[model samples]
Target chain A: MTNISRRDLLKSSAVTAAGATAGLTGIASASNHGKHNHSKSKRVVIVGGGIGGATAAQYLKKMDSDIDVTLIEANKNYHTCFMSNEVIGGVRPMDSIEFNYDKLAEKGIKVVFGSVINIDPDKQRVITKDNKVFSYDRAIVSPGIDFKYDEIEGYSKEVSETSIPHAWKAGPQTAMLLKQLQEMKDGGTFVIVTPPNPFRCPPGPYERASLVAAYFKKHKPNSKVVILDPKEKFSKFGLFMDGWKRHYGYGTDKSIITWIGKEAGGTVSKVDVATKTVTAEAGEFKADVLNIIPPQKAGPIAFETDLVGDLDWCSVDHKTFESTIHKNIHVIGDASIASPMPKSGYSANSQAKVCAAAIASSLNGVPMPDPSWVNTCYSIIAPKDGVSVAMVYAYKDGKIIKVKGSGGLTGPYNAEDRKREELYAHSWFNNITADIFG
Target chain B: MKQTKLILIGSALLASSTFINLAHATVIDRATILANTCAGCHGPNGISNGPLTPSIAGLPKNYISESMYDFATGKRPSTVMQRIAKGYTDADIKALSDYFSKLPKKATEPKKTNNHHGHNH
Candidate 1:
């Protein structure tokens, strides 16, 4: 094929040269984005459609043209693992947090709607629950996390399935929990039990309590919210306490929500799903509705693939995201053990981009680019008011560590600045959601 | 499995590159393993004297390497560090830490402020 398209290519290359003059960057040329020509293209199979998997699909498509990506998700629609707490409080419509795979499909990501029953790393093939098999050159698993039902006594998956609901993954159960909260009468007690450390979203349960109380303060007025925890403090304890006080009469007899750290006799020992009661070291409290977000581990695929060692999360080459157990397999998002990186949507999205670049470079003959990343996690406290922690990182000394003079928490203040931060946080969330899914 | 990867990566590094890092690397010829992008904020010599920055020079090589290893492995979580260290190796970390640790601390006119905490040992 004596393609005179070279002339067109040369012209476009000149246009690209001109665009570069204006600081515009296009798809890395090594990637193949041609029509029905994926035969020679490299394939990246991403498992799970949560923050990490979804963002990886989008960013991988964005960074290169030739990467044929197939995203495997059991659910056709994904209700965000983030922001489900707000749904419990009836702040935002559950529909607002729900997403379809259409966006990824539009971006050329092949959506395989089936549960990944097995990950054959050696074969570089994934078998789904539907008995379908798809092979790839590389596999990226970001299967978020699963709860450890056995960790807490009297509370297991079957128990939650029938009566008490974890509502952690935020689907029908999230709606069910919200419905239960809505039907509670005045002066009713809302009990939220939080799990011990090494869980997804450390500050999530507290935020749920705060947001639920935010709803109750306006609607029920006499309702009380109690938080029984396994930890002494949380991500933004001081800020949370201040915000609670300002909004929900916290620290007062009339406080809408009361948080009992472990020191305050809040460690939960057992739960009775039938009676809707939680027995903790502090006291045995019964609630009209119980929301328990449990401790987590890397999803079943991570364990089944033998990716995780002693830890419950996958071990990866922090720089490349390649799993320690398998050469061509990379694990990102909440599934992998990225210690210095939280399992938040934003962090997972950021990680996916870096991993995509590395994978692309490795696929081609070029050396990997010098990887740098930025992350900011935003939490909605009292509606538009939000807070965030932003940082920029560089790799050094063979490990990924923070560069000084870069990152800091939002603030320990309760002034106008914090409110402004909330607005910024909301904007950041909108931007990030767009950056990840849109 | 981690041990295997570390060993495999170590042998790969040793087999691939002949040069090793010493005290300080000049801007132009920083080794591929050294990847002096760390110099952007930590200082060219690994010692940070800026008001808000921590000094990293003269720290034990493993200490420096361990910190990075934590970030890379997710024992620690920072927004940037996780992304930056997503794809590094044991040899790379060792080489980079030695390069920075041996370099003389960056020179600056010292100021008397709350440079109080020595290091979070």
Candidate 2:
């Protein structure tokens, strides 16, 4: 057996080149647009243009050339929330994380820029804010996530716009938060209030805290970061804590970072915008910079369409991601009740592929295949110091469960290993973006 | 009694034939769906033209299957392949191996130079 190292596999540029070429050429050769040879044509309408929606559109066309895909998105451009923390930390610019639908359009998908106001399941149609109606044989919805601002007293959409910025959706708020962090003085305290469980990106709050700490370490050495989290445990807790101890002097009296869990009354109940103070169960704390990540639910579109039932998330069959409540409609990504799969960009992309395959198989009059999924989340503790967790899942016993002995976390902290993980993180960003858009 | 035995044998044959026909009619193309997932990263038909991901088309079935099993079991380490390998069952690994092995081996030429700007959207 030939043995290959992770570093060697990453350095194989020939393989990378072949993969890239195959992605683009494969799409072009598979799709025969403007050819009316098929006896019947199928229409697929997709809502939201994030990773999940965009991937589903592309894969649907590639799977069946004759299917008409119309993707309706509210914005002309989509700013990814995946790497926005880097923008706050001053590593990547905001424009670098922005995407457009020109690639989807080039793939013969009808990219419509409009808001979907309602969905008629019986009629199999979706209505837009502009009063336009689109009928489809199958509909896929991937509206990302929406915040519940009322959960935090004195925090509302208006406050998020003016004073506090969640920066969760990666738009103007992202820019505002970056400005706030950059302007703080030395020895200043930056307080980050993490939301409750089942939010987008489980390790996101910690990663943001790490990046902010990294920023202070370089620009203002005296500054410190305080993370108020509601959850007792988080994804990759041990790995993150280890890195924090080695780099940020965590657990020391003069540590640059302090993390308080729920047992210590870490959950914040109210925010005072005027005083820049957050009231937690334990006590009140003031900060030079305050970031409140409010509680979350499925995006508004899902609620408006009545796709979400009593559970704030849309119920779906783990096998095909088809909605259990509504026929001819499927939900993927963060909006669906896809547990055991943290709502990360990679997870959404993988789910979209499975949903696309199931939809195509249904339209082609074939049985759906038993589906498997893969997800890996990479967190950058500091520049060139990274860590990750990965898992593989399968549909079993009417639910998606992690495959036994399939995935694992990165081993103990080593400078060389961390640096390699960082490299892999960068390459992943490049490869995945290309795979989805092009 | 003799006539009843003949009728029972005929009924059993008819039922078996019907089952076979149903199986033939509804057979799921597991290999095709599985291949589509691989195409997302490796490229169509396992021939990638990208710079970092390898092309796995037209390799020997044993070679591909053994490599995947190694990745799944952590005998061979990779940044991404290990995660992907863990998602599959042994049956799936073998099926993918056999499917790709039968295709004629051909090298895919790179489509573009190193342009890391925004995707060609």
Best by lDDT: 2
Per-residue lDDT over A1-438 for candidate 1, one digit per residue giving the tens place of the 0 to 100 score? 122322355346545653453322332233222222222336788988887888778766654545678999988887876778778879778897877888889878998888988888877788888787777778899988889887677899887776788888878888888988999998899998898877777678878888889889889999999999989988767768887888888888989998888998998878887888988889898999887777789999888888897888898988889998898899998887776766776667767867876776665434565666555655666764566665666666656676565555665554554555554444344445555666
Off by over 4 Å in 2: A1-41, B1-28, B35-63, B78-84, B98-121
Docking class of 2: incorrect
The runs of at least 3 residues in candidate 1 whose Cα sits more than 4 Å from the true structure, single-residue gaps closed, are A1-41, A412-415, B1-121
TM-score of 1: 0.71
lDDT of 1 at A118: 89
Q: In candidate 1 chain A, where is summed lDDT lowest over 10 consecutive residues?
A: A31-40
**Could you give the CAPRI-style class of model 1?**
incorrect
Q: B40-99 in candidate 2: lDDT tens per residue?
A: 455555665455455567879998898887776768755556666777777888888987
Instruction: Give Cα distance to truth, residue A33, candidate 2, Å.
Output: 23
